[model samples]
Target: MLDYRLFKQIDDCFASGHADKARRLLMEVQSRSIALRDEMNMLHIRLKTLEDALQLARNLFNRDGFYWLKTGDVTQGPFCPRCYEDEGALIRLERTGSKLHCPYCHASFIGSARAAGGGAHHAHILPFV
Candidate 1:
């Protein structure tokens, strides 16, 4: 989910009557939100596969099994731990500085992955045969 601060900023910008600024920020937020949702869906599928594999391991070996990490129904990262990649979840403009942080993992990057390139930070694909 995109942070509430993003919506607030959009509101603030529009409230200030800067149409161009508000439009640009809103567009950026929308783009980031879409990318985050896609990544989250992929993570869900990947974690499900991992869970299935662990179940099989438990059945076959009849021993202690390694399990995937998850916080509630979601896996435990907004940034890919393997790559330290990040997606924007919240926008903050405090007195210190402006920065973006992921609400899930609390990882902060220089900028949104999409703005840096054209897609999310790293595309992780699991190989199946």
Candidate 2:
């Protein structure tokens, strides 16, 4: 978003034998260029963040009361539903006995019996706490 008029002003300064003014204008141009570069880098970072959010939205699903992330043929999580619903975060649940716990929100869920057996119902929940 640099103004092209600055370059013309620099050219006019040089034509009018205002060498000091031309040098100052050149420095201004350099400063503007650096600012533009930094702004572009920030925009790229924002774009990457938005893309990652889109991908997560496309892949995330709910089974029973818990959240799961699926990519390709692989399924990834038994995330905390309360955390995801309230904060848009994919906080992984920690299993203990027949219960799953969310460390972030201190929420607990009743995990499936098949969870201990490494079955497909791993971390699948029946109720919330």
Candidate 3:
């Protein structure tokens, strides 16, 4: 916080021909300004991180023991539940045989089977709750 009294003291020092004292006071003001700027920047970063987490929480949904991210009309992911629940990470699960595998946490989940006509297997998409 900037103290108005410091400015008065600095002015008085300069008027009394105390150049060194005035210079030292100016340096103190500069240091305070820099520290204030750093604190503000850190607060901005924290606020942005919190906003991102809130957005993700708003879009994230769970179904059949799996997590999914739904955005607008486009839904993406069948993220690993264990990784998300334990570590707060949305690790996308890779399909392998009859399971979905997490490359990051090495966890697995049972996925839907392929269609009879060899079409792609589709998981049931649900709305975010």
Residue-by-residue lDDT tens digits, candidate 2, 1-129? 688899999999999999999999899899999999999999999999999999998999877667888889877767888889999999988887878888888777775523222545534334543
After superposing candidate 3 on the true structure, give the runs of residues whose Cα lies further than 4 Å from its correct spot.
Answer: 113-129
Instruction: State the displacement of the C-alpha of residue 129, model 2, in Å, after optimal TM-score superposition.
Output: 9.8
* Candidate 1 collision pairs: none
Best by the TM-score measure: 3
**CA lDDT of every candidate:** 0.47, 0.80, 0.78
Alpha-carbon error at 123 in model 3, in Å?
11
lDDT over C-alpha atoms for residue 118 of model 2: 51
Tell me the RMSD of model 1 versus the true structure. 24.2
Worst 10 residues of 3 by lDDT: 113-122
**Candidate 3 TM-score, true structure as reference:** 0.81
- Model 2, C-alpha of 63: deviation from truth (Å): 1.3
Task: Select the stronger candidate by TM-score from 2 and 3.
Answer: 3
- lDDT score, candidate 3: 0.78
Report the Cα RMSD per candidate.
24.2, 3.9, 6.8
Query: What is the Cα-based lDDT of residue 26 in candidate 3?
Result: 98
